[model samples]
Target: MRRWASVVAALALALPGPAAAQDPIAVPSPILTIDQDRLFEETRLGQHSTREIDAAAEALTDENRRIEEDLRAEEISLTERRGSMSAEEFAGLADAFDAKVQAIRAEQDAKARALASRQEEARQAFFVEVAEILSEIVREEGAVVILDRRDVFLSADRIDITDQAIARINAAGRQTPAAPAPATPAPDPVPDPVPPPADQ
Candidate 1:
């Protein structure tokens, strides 16, 4: 195994780098990019949704705090009464308190999950409406495809249409039509893909 390892190492060092093996493809001209995250964070619709979500989260926090205070008070009261009550009666009350705490925790957890789902729904709705604006920009630019900026390794700033999309979305105001479900694309196989060389 040691002899084979040395031979493999020698062969790897003799191989040429990727650049020497193949020429790099020039950036495609008809491809445009947009910052999907920026589209969600900067648009008026996004801001509106964010404000509502934040308010709801704060309210949830307040409710949790109040519940905790109430529970703590009940616990102290129960402790004080433990001395006066019969042992069996005190045990029953303590068991009920524990069950109530567990039930409250489960209810609060469900509420938190519902809040998260609401946030996701808002994001999906924003994208559905913004897709129309993006399509218009693509048509105007005569671009073949709109890629998420994060997916592209290198591209000219001129190809980015995020700002344009945001402006159009905000300008559309409250009169914008109701959003439909997002279109899902069919998957296709890549042709002759070259795997990157592994490190020695």
Candidate 2:
């Protein structure tokens, strides 16, 4: 009976238990990777920011087109009257028109730079808002570091957290509010060139 009991015990020890029978548990990597570009581009906050910037750019384009048309018409009118005026008077008007164009161009250039700055601000804000979620992921994964995927030469696909991050951002309903559109001053209408005094 003792021999029989010993045999049974040995058999039990040799046989795989329920835990061993199951698939091995995957160990989380201490180092993780994320695609920062995808994290920004695919996230709700990023999308919202992009839309706002694009709308502003489109509006600026429309304004530029209208201003160009107005300037073109003014130029034609000025040219038509050139034949009636002395060269000196025409030169003065021409110089003034050129100066006005330069001023408008400078103003528009500044606006374009502001738009670029706004875009950068939006990107910075996005990262700031998501910092908490990223921290949580790092803790959950037991990761010591999260490297940008672009910086790594080669890495396993499983380690990338960009898609996961995007999903979390969506789930959290994170969205950037539309920034107030910059006030666009109407392009000053080119004043009608004053007619020259009648020759003596």
Candidate 3:
């Protein structure tokens, strides 16, 4: 009987305690959903890039107009000179005109490449800012995992923090003033007109 009682006590001690009465494998629902687009649009860096891109586009337009005008003027001059020139001279002028056109095209191509590179760089910087904000949100919400709204099939409105994220991102971005635009050098001062010599 003593041996039986000792065996029973040992068995009871080995069994799970009261703390183990509850389920150990409870699955948690996601706490929040994020809309990456909204976050990107609302970010401070995004706004800055938008403004910069607009300015770049406007400048490009002006550059294009200048190029077009130069081409048109060259064409007009070539036409007028062709009427007075020998065939050889006209051919040389045509070749020169072609060279000028090619040069202008190359310049335009360079400008386009530069613009694309700058835009890409700006986008990368904007995304980095978004990533930092998302990290902060994750910590604050105690979320085990955050899903992009685009990826989820369905999520309750309560679980969506996209609007809140945008607000935070915008607020953080607005705290710092945008960097000043680089100054364009002023055009060289017009030379003073010399007085015509008195007629003899």
Candidate 4:
């Protein structure tokens, strides 16, 4: 009877009785990659950003030109009449022109800074939406990691999500706020025109 029981146990072992059904090991998926440069150039948000930058530059150029033209006219007038004017009067005119030039420079710089700030704000909003979409993609593809395409040396184009990212960006339609008007700071105090040397 004991021999019979031993034989039965041996048969059970050989028959594949559930001996520690090990939990299926979880394996990490392959890393996914994105062509960020392409996304930036081709995406709707990117194109919008480019347009905003271009518009800002054009506006700045127009303002600079207007200021320059005015200054040029004043300079020409000063140059043409310098011979007849008193030394004091000419010096005063020159000083005024210099002050105008400085003011224009400050204004233009402020405008540029405001435009840049708006652009950055838009870019940050775009990336936030991008991250949300990427989370979905990660689950869909079972990707363990996401890396910039620039960093990756070799990868199947199948892993490239640039087009999809661009599409989602367009769909998101994240609105960029218009640039804020630059605050008018108090003008710098004009220095007193230096008195011409007594001998001159």
Q: On residues 1-200, what C-alpha lDDT tens digit does candidate 1 reach at each position?
A: 99988987777675445665475434434888999889888888888777778888899999999999988998898899889867767777787788778777877787787788777887777887777788888888878899998898655566788898889988987333223223444334222212234335
lDDT of 3 at 157: 53
Candidate 4 weakest ten by summed lDDT: 16-25
What TM-score goes with each of the models?
Answer: 0.67, 0.74, 0.61, 0.66
Poorest 10 consecutive residues of model 2 by lDDT? 189-198
Clashes of each: 0, 0, 0, 0
Locate the minimum summed-lDDT window of 10 residues in model 1: 187-196
Which one wins on TM-score? Answer: 2
lDDT of 3 at 149: 84
Q: Cα deviation of 105 in candidate 2 (Å)?
A: 0.5
RMSD of 2: 14.1
lDDT of 2 at 162: 86
Candidates' C-alpha lDDT? 0.75, 0.82, 0.67, 0.70
- Residue pairs with clashing backbones, model 3: none
Residue 124 of model 2, lDDT score: 82
Residues 74-154, model 2: lDDT tens digits? 899889988987898898889888888887788788788778888877888889999999989889988888999889865
Off by over 4 Å in 2: 1-27, 179-200
lDDT of 2 at 171: 94
Ranking by lDDT: 2, 1, 4, 3
Off by over 4 Å in 3: 1-37, 140-160, 174-200
